[model samples]
Target: MDDNKNLFKQIQALYRGLFAFVVAFALIGVGLIAYMNNPQLFTSDITASETEYVPIPEDDSDKIEDGVHVRTGFVEADGLMETVNNCTNCHSSELVLQNRMSKENWIATIRWMQETQNLWDLGGNEEIIVAYLVKNYPVIKKGRRGALTDIEWYDL
Candidate 1:
């Protein structure tokens, strides 16, 4: 009879512990539901007068040139955003601005990047990007300075 009573007490303690655990879990669940239903209840409110405000002076250096994007310096034209998004991800916009090339060269460069640099396939955006680059930054005829016209020979 004593052994039986001890076993019953042990079972009662286990049931009580389980009930407490379930109650704790249910309370947490209810708290989460309440929070999910109305989270603004937990957020603090502040009046504008409590915070300090400062004004920033506007600088126009980047925006001086018309049709030039202030941020990337990309010419404002069709396909501008596409080129900026696709090309500027891996490298800076300055790189694109500097390397002026024809459409064929741009295609070749893109292919090279894909083969070596793990650049993703651009699909239709390739044409747009190449067009934007070729339009805005096409190759300039750069070579040795014009033939010397009035150069005098120096004595050895």
Candidate 2:
């Protein structure tokens, strides 16, 4: 009876140690992921080289029908453009420009970032981003030329 009781206690102790170790490991893993996904905490050390290309502003006065300003250069629309504050903190504007998505998808992506990736809120800027994405990144439609004409093929 004594040996059985001792064996049971040893088994319980082993399980307790294992449980503690697992909990500690899980906590550390969560911490590491949170740190890595937190854009506010992460930063890039890369610098642009002299050979790197920079986009030059274009003159829009000639393009516009009226005296009103039109978007002819990148900087002209920069104010109205939606920027993911957290995303651009470590990434470049080109990165944002290259990626495009619908308004719904953008909202979902932002939510995912907020829930799991530790992305910060944009406050009033959220509307600006959503509007910009909807206006500029609308879904693509099929071209008229792609559809086959009735006279193009004869019935076999």
Among these predictions, the greatest TM-score belongs to 1
Q: What TM-score would you give candidate 2 relative to the actual structure?
A: 0.38
Candidate 2 residue-wise lDDT, 1-156, digit = tens: 999999999999999999999999999888889888874444553553336686888764335335322432223233343453444554565655665678898788778778886777878787777666666655676566575666666689
| Local error of candidate 1 at residue 116 (angstroms) | 0.9
Give me the runs in candidate 1 sitting further than 4 Å from their true place.
1-65, 142-156
Model 1 lowest lDDT segment of ten: 40-49
Model 1 error, position 3 (Å) = 99
